[model samples]
Target chain A: MRHLIDISDLTRDETNELIETASDIIVNPDNYTNKCSRKKIATLFYEPSTRTRLSFESAMLDLGGSVIGFSSAQYSSVSKGESVADTVRTVSCFADIIAIRHPKEGAALVAAMNSPVPVINAGDGGHNHPTQTLTDLLTIVREKGRLTDLTIGCCGDLKFGRTVHSLITAMARYSGVRFVLISPDELVIPEYLRNGVLKRENIPYVETRSLDESIAELDILYMTRVQKERFFNEADYVRLKDSYILTPDKLAHAKSDMRILHPLPRVNEISTAIDYDPRAAYFRQVRYGKFIRMALILKLLEEAEE
Target chain B: MIIGSIVNGIVIDHIPAGRGMELYKLMKLNELKCEIALIENAKSEKLGKKDILKIGEMLPFDYSILGYVDSRITINFIENGKRVRKEHPSMPEILSDIIKCKNPRCITTTEQELPHKFRLSDRESLSYRCVYCESKAQSN
Candidate 1:
């Protein structure tokens, strides 16, 4: 693919190839250190995102390439009313590849359309973050040893959790994958998702307001923050957030090998006490996130050569 | 029938009753200088009541948006005051710059020159999502 706008942009074989590349990078670090030694990557972040921005920067720097561009929109030409298309076009003159995180949906699509180099969408509103999905997949593959025939439970804000949405989209292409959607009724998975991806793909799924009831059956529990702002009533947020929290006590009923995953910067969704558990794969997932991005940067640069 | 048939134009028939004015406004029929007739509450054996529109000019009609608005609409070609062929408009695979993407975060909303595009995601549900963001289009 020319650009990484959504998880669907990459075929299953391409996704697996990236995972393999990342695994190879993990083992033979020195051999791939200076792969992009002469190239430059522009982190054109039109939004303030510490983790994603750092991840992209690290991906380029670790590959022996230079990183450029602003960390936020306030510091960029966008403050002077520059359009996303124009900003990407301008960056194309300097950078060999561009990674953008924007507050607006489809900002990367605009960048991709205008960019002379390959464009990678770091994150665009709540629309998509394909790299995050890549990280999650790698994490799951490492922990579970396979992607298919697994019961994946997504907890908390399934309504607005782009990570969960992307995970579902990617995993649905596999065989014997089932979804256990855990969220409050108001924050339930969108109908378009249930009707569009799950039903259309014939992927089995079951929904519940309570995660505790289904925790034992899940092989992977993907937790996301249930923000207070998403709830119409403060009382509802207070009441519902507690139901989704993953404490050690909650994991008592869970599978012995159940891997807990989160797109971190988590806010009380997964307890700090649970971090001590061997099954908690979120931190390890961060390293995979960096590697997958490294693989993506190299892949895009290689594709640009043709 | 209060108006005569078109000499050479389009005949939009079988629009559900009470939708003629909406279709008229959406099509901007009033903006056209050529003759156009809108019949409300027209009788039909297939439909208890329906609306019909006749335009004496051939213009590009976004069939996808029309399919979304009213799939039952039948468009008939009239040549020299005779019906030549009739077509039942079905949803197109891709729709461009007809139904606007209302999501403020959408690229088309800010980059005014770019065409607002949507691809049919769920043909069974008659669902169309924005090509860029994949957000479901608000066809209603």
Candidate 2:
């Protein structure tokens, strides 16, 4: 009955277990090769995503499981007016498990309510992506070897970043976690998240506009693209774009031990020149994404039969 | 102070002053055929000025709604002109098809057929969030 709808669905221990499982997979790939050999994973991606859908497919394949289902709503019966409930009910008969990515929020919940098989929310309209949180956690733990007592500086698009919201929720549970929020005033973190979640939990956090200064103290710097489309004024986008971009000069100011992360598909927000730097964890973050998903798929399927 | 007691009806007492009319409208008290007197600004020992709803007949009412409107309300069931039962409405953990989710990006906004559901998150603050998006419900 358990589904990966939100990052908070898994506790600190459960999240740690996923990180541990992914690490174990990295060491002994052969041990988990046939764990899901006979299982079928149906990916009901209502929205088109290159990384998420392929990551799930890649994970299922790596686990020795078969992958089925559509890439977008236009290709499926959804174009002919099929409800998520109806689609999932029908898919339940065909597949042993489901990983759904939809543009609508709570679309996975609708499918899970109707689905007989185990359901994993790949991504649901910037609402929750537990699997990505798993990937981030695994990367952080692998790079830093610890989860708690670290300063996490989040730069750019804090207001609309689903990853930022989920990470804040997950990291708040751990002790000695401080947040350094760096963003333009227009794109500052939502008050409800700051007040309802962080303030309620009593987690220490500071808001600032300077990424250059904040970089020196952070153990982990999470960068997100602040889209030009989000700005009503073209001038505002041009002014703020350069400030958030991580260049070589900015890297020099940062701690040599600090790790840089991004949920990829960057557009000038991060300088390509910094990719060669040992501290840039974004590209390496992608490969670890597959391993975390493999661990998630294995865990969900294992827990489903129980 | 002597509002006539009902023989076989329910008395909704302890509603805050001036809120009874809103409750009456929300609960659709006008739809009932029985005599319903909305006593506003009634003097009370505990409350200086409270409202009392005196119904003349027994009918099935959704008392669960009272918890949302005003939890301070006490419903008294009068059987044969004698008080039989007195209890407050029970607050629900989850409410469906009641309050609409206001978040523009929420699934319910695009999927019109989906039920507008909210879950009671904090009891002390009476905070309810959209089950789908976790956006706090804006109280009317």
Candidate 3:
């Protein structure tokens, strides 16, 4: 069975198809209300998440599918030391597909390996969140008009930001796309992503500490929170938590059409005042997240049947 | 010092000098009850200096493990004390349960039954990354 443990698991054409389907769904919501009638989705969230779990549930509900499963490890058999393999194996019998979110990296992959039905990785620690990348891709396609020929500036906590790595991997397939990586020295993109994807693929990119200097050249600014859970030291988290705050002054040099995006639950990274600005598309990005997930579920379930 | 040749065994040749013991240990040859001889820092025309291992019995094992350790090493099959066939093992594309992933957040850490698997990501650099977490394997 097919599983989306990483964004790269879906080829460029498949990704485009998902985007196209999501866009179509946005225009004609009524036509797909019963697309997943009598289908069931198991959401096995081993970690706490407000947006992703709800987004998956909402997407499944909107498609006329029912949702089952736990929201946290403490509430499930995982608290009694059940392996991801066993959990997914048991869940696969009841649900047509599974959406899993776990605190440990590669937990989703473990689930996918064991599950007979399709598995969707909601979020797997700081490793990968393919759906978020899909959502970001959809937002970029909707806001910026094209995925190609755009300079994306990713700011703050690029190190542990799974969305950033997945985005760069997905976008590298497109032509004329450049990146301006804006982050403090402590949290640059990982070497595997740097040398493996960017350098190996011959993609053009620039690394800078000054968000103000890089903001002007970007068509899209992806703001990320410096996640406290990723840091081993509390002092390090405190020092870097307020590294880059996007205020009105920072956007003075940015283009009028520059779309500001964030994988939200944002902690003061983007100022609340900027939420009123037309450039702030993070909220709209969340809505796009739901639609793209709907498209993903429809695609996975249909493919499973075939 | 002369080490006697085996009658019907396997000869491992062309191991880079100073790594014979590591390869032997890694392959778990110590567990074998058969006679085993390890000759280290032997003069070689091809490698300048090399190590050779002679096993007294024809044992079955995956040569890819040897290749993953050092691809330059070659294995020879002896039927009647003379070299009958020679084999060269290339680096394996995937390694299972050979090395442990050090990443604390990796699922392998919590799942005791899970095999530690790594894929050869960069051939030129000889870099292997964990199949699950994508963490680079530490060189021995």
Candidate 4:
């Protein structure tokens, strides 16, 4: 009866409950293996995304559910101009739940409205990705042992990074959570998010151009790619591209316990040399991603039964 | 050369000739309790044709609703068979909540149970955007 079209739809308590359920699944994977035995999950990905699509597919598979639907829009009736409403309504008759990713903003919201089954937004154009935020939250809670009172530094492409926006919104709900935003002037945290979410919640935060200065002080350093396309000026992109690189030498000042996180598909933002460092948790975050997704699939299917 | 007049009501005049039906749909005046007269294709040297809506009873209207359909509608507050007050159109700060967003991928386009929400991003330009999908639309 409910859809997760936006992170704001989930209250702080609901978020914590999901995290707790995900944790329980991690502990007892056997008990939830057949949770969605005869159910089906349709992944309607309109864009090319191997990692996220595979994550959802694998999550449903692990929950003993079958996966149906296309990996791209080109293969679907969308190429012939079938409307999203008609597509979702038809798909709902076959699938119990749907996960959709579209290049257009609010596409999932649209699908959710027409879908008879619950809808999950995998990713929509620079808007929101609540699932990725869920994965990140689960990773942080598991790695940092707590969500509050931590100095979380988010670096690169903050303006357009949906992941960054979702993470900031989720973290702002916790107490004593300070943020250090690291990005070029063009990619600084958007004013809407800064004023609407951060300032409104009275969450203490600081913005800086130097990632090195704040790199050591952060309890968790989350990195995202600063793509050249996001820049209007090529020269500016070239100048600021290397400002957020997380090299092993840079980790020297970081606490031995300081956890480094990245959403993956790193384009030199994170140096491969830091892969050996025990503080690097991005790879482990991937494994945790699968586990948490497995947990999510079980929970959603169980809720469908109720 | 005489036309029927309401005993005690409002008269919307100077509605760009043939656009009275559109104005009617925009205001949803047919759903109201008052007696309505829609005079269409009336002779006018300036517009070549014009239409008028004479209501038989006083009905409250925001008048700003005219901004969406036609800006030429002139509302006359007739008192004792005298035009006491005449109101003309001005640019509106907000647009009507009707007219669904054209973007097929927009949430508002598919959501049947929710009210279609739009915000006038540029009033002078007559540009509006879907609050959910962020799709831009312009009034032509």
The i-RMS of every model, in angstroms, reads 1.3, 1.2, 0.6, 3.8
Alpha carbon lDDT at A39, candidate 2: 89
lDDT of 4 at A154: 95
Candidate lDDT values, in order: 0.87, 0.87, 0.93, 0.81
Scoring only the A-chain of each prediction against the true A-chain gives TM-scores of 0.96, 0.95, 0.99, 0.95
lDDT of 4 at A62: 81
DockQ-based class of model 4: acceptable
- Grade the docking of candidate 2: medium
- State every prediction's TM-score relative to the real structure: 0.92, 0.90, 0.97, 0.76
How would you encode candidate 3's per-residue C-alpha lDDT over A49-77 as one tens digit per residue?
99999999999999999999999999999
lDDT of candidate 3 over B1-140, digit per residue (tens): 98988999999999999989988887889999999999999999999999999999888888887887788889999988899999988889998888889999998999999999999988888889999888889855
Better of 2 and 3 by DockQ: 3
Candidate with top lDDT is 3
Residue-wise C-alpha lDDT for candidate 1, range B27-123, written one tens digit per residue = 7788899988889999988889999988998777675456766788998988888999888878877878667798876767766778888898877
* Candidate with best DockQ: 3
DockQ of each: 0.69, 0.62, 0.83, 0.27
Q: Write the per-residue lDDT of candidate 1 for residues A192-275, one digit (tens) a residue.
A: 789879998889999998888999999999999876644557897787676678888899999889999999888888889999
User: Model 4 off-target regions past 4 Å?
Assistant: A228-243, B1-116, B119-129, B134-140
lDDT of 2 by residue, A28-52 (tens): 9999889999888999998778888
Candidate 4 residue-wise lDDT at A115:
81
